[model samples]
Target: MRWTALYARSRHLTVALAAVLLCAAVLPLLLGDSWSTVFATVTLGAAVAVAGVGLSGQDLDLDRTASFRWPPRRLTHLLVIGVVAGGVMLAAQGLADLPIDSSWILRDVAGLLGLTGLAATLFGGQFGWTLPMGWAMTAALVPKAVGQAYDVVAWPMATADSAQAWWVAGLLFVAGTAAYTMAGAHR
Candidate 1:
């Protein structure tokens, strides 16, 4: 599949996968839940950063020329970008021995997709990781943002008690996807 082709050539994807693997092996065993959160933030922070893999001026033109699945190349590629990052989240969770709450972590993944997509659209993939990573680090280390903004900010931080978090995360995912697709379409 064309998605496979894109993934094979993506340095961002490569690094993201490697990071998830390393964190899975080391973080849970070495530290407590605090470090696990740190890992979660960092890994999900990769949302947009991973999109950087095949994104460039040249890559845009290439995508325009190549037709993948039913969706436009841009849409499919971005979808794959999100999906791969989400998979990394799942792997990290399983390895870390976190509870099997799909909605909780999935909301995080969806929110990340949105953040990463938004970052990639606004800033370009060159600095895709900057905003999300900054947000993640702040959320993890600062404590203030994480507690208050978990639901407000969206992402995995949203507690399990609220169904609203799922809606917010889905909104983020759609918004981010639209932004990315529109940006590429216009350019």
Candidate 2:
């Protein structure tokens, strides 16, 4: 119990949770009865971006010095971030009576979380938010079209039924999870 609390504090989990909740709650209210795909994508991006800060601890050296194995912990942390962000968004959408599908939210959250993990592994935990936000921005700015290539590039904003988007998101989730689990975050 004590150890769990200490771990949460060290990783700033409370702050991340609060920020995720806030983003989730606010976005639905702001959109009101007009929910767009782009808005949903941006909302998920904001939630992941704020929560991703805890992907690494305060000191990489200190984390390395710890006695316990890290891979499992890292994997669990990433999964928890996905669940929290996705769950909050789903709940908010439900409250707003929006018609967003669960599969779409799940896909976006998975891919975004994967990007967060990949960023943490490549650029350190502090930078974990960059890849997701950057990708989301790109997805938002790109003109919508109908094509496999476009679906891959805009996977974050792709419709739930897009096969290309699902494949891309799945690949990203697997690769990012594996990399982050094995390498942890960069110093």
Candidate 3:
């Protein structure tokens, strides 16, 4: 029983950490080639990280009969958090004299929602979710690492969307959630 409880706790922690690492890894790619895009990615990443922190921190609070007072309130809280994150980022950009504008906040919100949709699909266990999530993470991380390695091995080559990269990322995300679900059952 003790070991089982320990495993559960550890698994939850692992998921939260994975969430952080995944977002951090993807932030660079999601930034693409625009200052606004970079700011938006960073902002959304921060918001998601914050949400993960909140959810993970309250893992034990699952016992609460009312985890949320109401569904709309839950949405409200998320929006409030997003606003705070965007406002904070904007303030920092202003102080630093970065060319970032507040208009990017809307884009950031949309990107954050897209990421959340992907994450939710992974968590909700539809179609081989487990393997894909893990694979997606690995796929995302491997390219950046390879880029660094190639710079050392050969002349720096500009990265482009490769066929293998797309397949790996897509497959991993779709299958990883399934893998996660299977792993959850074993625990």
Candidate 4:
């Protein structure tokens, strides 16, 4: 078997990918005409949360002992999660003729993937879904108040063009990516 296939199997990537694809494909269709930024945020968050489970392998010590470098692999894993989640959602929305903006999907996927990475780094890979799901739920529930504070707090649900939302998402993406790449999921 190929090294890539072995790595993917060890990380349960197939299960995570299936779950992400399912969420991305089904959520928007269920929402139908009522789809909006909030639903999009939730859908993306769920997809990322599901895929993030594979951020770390079953045995951290064994993984660390591997001869190959880990940083690049970790970075690629995160990027792939974002790409797959975002790409599936975009395709689903396009097929259904939903009104979700591509920009919003991009921003939310990046931010949510970052949050998952951060969660994995801090709480271990098994718990990586917590941060993204928690933030998405909070954003969906919070009232839409005006101002930078609200935008930052509810970045996931913010409009596609909101400057504050973009900044927060970008910062999270950079910080989470850097931290996770430098330090694989917490032992």
Best by the lDDT measure:
4
Residue 60 in candidate 1, Cα distance off native in Å:
4.1
Best by TM-score: 4
Off by over 4 Å in 4: none
Error of 3 at 124 (Å): 7.7
Mark the regions of model 1 whose C-alpha exceeds 4 Å error after superposition.
Answer: 1-35, 51-53, 57-71, 141-150, 185-187
Give lDDT tens digits, candidate 4, residues 1-187: 4868978998899999999988998888888989887888888899999988888899999899988899999999999999999999999988899988899899998889889999999998988899999999899988876666878999998889999999999989988888899998998
What are the RMSDs of all candidates, in order? 4.1, 1.2, 11.7, 1.1
Poorest lDDT segment (10 consecutive residues) of candidate 1:
49-58
Error of 1 at 38 (Å): 4.2
Which residue segments of model 3 deviate by more than 4 Å?
Answer: 1-40, 56-64, 117-187
lDDT of 2 by residue, 1-187 (tens): 7767878998899999999998877877888978788888888998997888789988889888888899999999999999999999999888898878899999999899889999999999999999888898899887776566779999988889999999999998898888899999998
Query: All candidates' TM-scores?
Result: 0.68, 0.96, 0.40, 0.96
How high is the CA lDDT of each candidate model?
0.58, 0.88, 0.37, 0.90
State the lDDT of candidate 1 residue by residue for 1-187, as single tens digits.
7666564565355665565445433444455465545565565665445454344343556655655442455567666766666665576567666653546556666666666667777777665556556666655664434564565654455465667667776887898778866674223
Candidate 3 per-residue lDDT, tens place, 1-187, comes to: 6643543363354554444444433443344455443344443455444333332122323423443343343244334434555555555555444544455444333334333334433443122123223322333334445654432221111122333423333443344234322222110
Ranking by lDDT: 4, 2, 1, 3
TM-score of candidate 2 against the unseen true structure:
0.96
